[model samples]
Target: MEIVSFEQLDSTQNYLIEALEKSQLQAPLAVIASEQTGGIGSRENLWHSSRGDLLFSFALPLSWLPDDLPLGSSSIYFAYIMKETLIEFQSSIWLKWPNDIYYCENKIGGVVTKMIGKNLVCGMGVNLKKNQKGFEALSIGVEPTFVCKMYLNGLDKKPTWKHIFRKYKLEFDYHKNISTHIMGQKISLHNAVLCDDGSLLINKKRIYSLR
Candidate 1:
């Protein structure tokens, strides 16, 4: 995995896309930035990226994955893999139904996936040592690159769905057993549902979907 680090950037996702387009580069590229000024979030929200946080984006060609797997499932698989990694450092870390990483209740990080031509770009932001306002930090300490390398190394092994499923199931179970705190109110995890189409059902209402 090739890593390109920048001291500062408007947004790691935008920078990565531009770099790939400019270079006509294929998939399997990573872009990391020390600071992102205009980081993105789901639904056009701004991703608050404070300095010292982990901000990175990577792309993979669609051919790298199995054709039968839906794009939404792939994102869920990647999110589960990442949640498992963070659990090693912070056991309190829980996955919000789809791809948001939460520390107890407050969001600590998130994952975003976008399709570019026949390729897929997965962007991740983690609040390691620092966090912006309205968010929480992991109680346990971790190196930014340490987490990044774990993901990249796993990818290097070119794991199949069978290999990923074992880990995904375990993390999904853990997520299910946990409770969710929304807007300062505690709610049971049973109210959350993972729909067949990869959308999250909150109180029987569809909420978020990877697509």
Candidate 2:
């Protein structure tokens, strides 16, 4: 994958998406910034971050995705892999159901996805440095660039969906105490059932992480 790094940017996702749309860049490419001024979040929200946050967006061909992977669960798939990457550094960060990144009870960062033509673009914002208030930072020390490179290196191996799902299920229990938003309403995950395709069955209503 080709990676382009910047000292600062408004939003990596926006820049990458526009590049792809204008034929300036292609899939399997990544854009990173040392500081993101205007990051995006799920539901058209803004992902505010400080100087040392891990801000990046990468695009991959849809055909390169695992055959058994469900489109709606792309956010979880991407987020879990990143959570696994952080664990390699001895960090205690865990992925909340769907896409949020958490440390114990506080959130440290999040992942969001978007479809651009035949490619899938995933944007991740992680707090590796303690520069933001209210939100907690990562538990371990790591150079943001190193973590980004290592993550893409691991992704190049292309683990199967079944493999990631098996591991993610083991940690699904951590979400029972939390709640998630669905159609503008917050719903508890305590009774949410993790389906084979990664959707949750809450009160008989199926919910997906289609960020």
lDDT of 1 by residue, 94-118 (tens): 6665567888767888888888777
Best by TM-score: 2
Candidate 2 has what TM-score? 0.95
RMSD of candidate 1 to the truth, in angstroms, is: 4.1
TM-score of each: 0.79, 0.95
Worst 10 residues of 1 by lDDT: 178-187
Question: Candidate 2: where is the Cα deviation over 4 Å?
Answer: 132-134
| Candidate 1, superposed: residue stretches over 4 Å from native | 131-134, 161-208
lDDT per prediction? 0.71, 0.87
lDDT of model 1 at position 86 = 81
* Local lDDT at 127 for model 2: 82
Candidate 2 per-residue lDDT, tens place, 1-211, comes to 8899999999999999999999999898999999888899867788878877789999999999999999899998989889888888755678888889887777878898999999999999988778636557874667788899999998888888899999898788765877888888888888889998999998888888888
